[model samples]
Target: MISNLSELLAVAPEEIDVNEPFSRLGLDSAAAVGLIGDLEHLLGRSLSPTLAYDHPTISDLARHLGGEGK
Candidate 1:
């Protein structure tokens, strides 16, 4: 998930801080869609852009993808 997030955000995997905003990572809706597409393949479920909005950082998204979403 972290690797996916890093790829989607166009940053080094090590550079993504859970404390930082996703916008700072330069991700927009287009990238979110692409990321969701990949996630769907891995998770065997669809993910909406709303999930990207709700789950901002990699850690948050990891939790969500892990099926423990808030």
Candidate 2:
């Protein structure tokens, strides 16, 4: 997910902070929608269109998807 955000924001993966909000990384609505599609493909499950809004930070998103806590 960090890699995805990094690509979307045109930044290095190391530059992304798990605790920071996606908006801070310049995740506008279009980017968020694209991200959702990528996530769905990677996760192999259908996700809500508003998933990014519900899980605003990388850490929060991880927890939402039952991943290890950041």
Candidate 3:
């Protein structure tokens, strides 16, 4: 997920702080949609269009999607 975000943001993967709000990383709604599309493709499943808003941070989203435990 961090790799994907870094690619989208044109930043190094290490620069993506997991706890930071995606909006703080410059991910506006449109960008979030684009991100969701990428994630859907990668995950091989449909996801809520508002998923980004629903989980505003990388860690939050990852946890919600069962990527990481609490």
Per-residue error at 31 for model 1, in Å? 0.4
1 against 2, candidate with superior TM-score: 2
Give the better candidate number (1 or 3) by lDDT: 3
Query: Model 3, residue 3: displacement in angstroms?
Result: 1.3
Candidate 2 lDDT tens digits, 1-70 = 8888888899999999999898988899989989989999999999998989989988898898895553
- Residue 56 in model 1: shift from native, Å? 1.3
TM-score of 3: 0.89
lDDT head-to-head 1 vs 2, winner: 2
lDDT of 3 by residue, 1-70 (tens): 8888898889999988999999999888988999999999999999998999989998899898885654
2 against 3, candidate with superior TM-score: 2
| Local error of candidate 3 at residue 61 (angstroms) | 0.3
TM-score of each: 0.74, 0.90, 0.89
Estimate the lDDT of model 2: 0.89
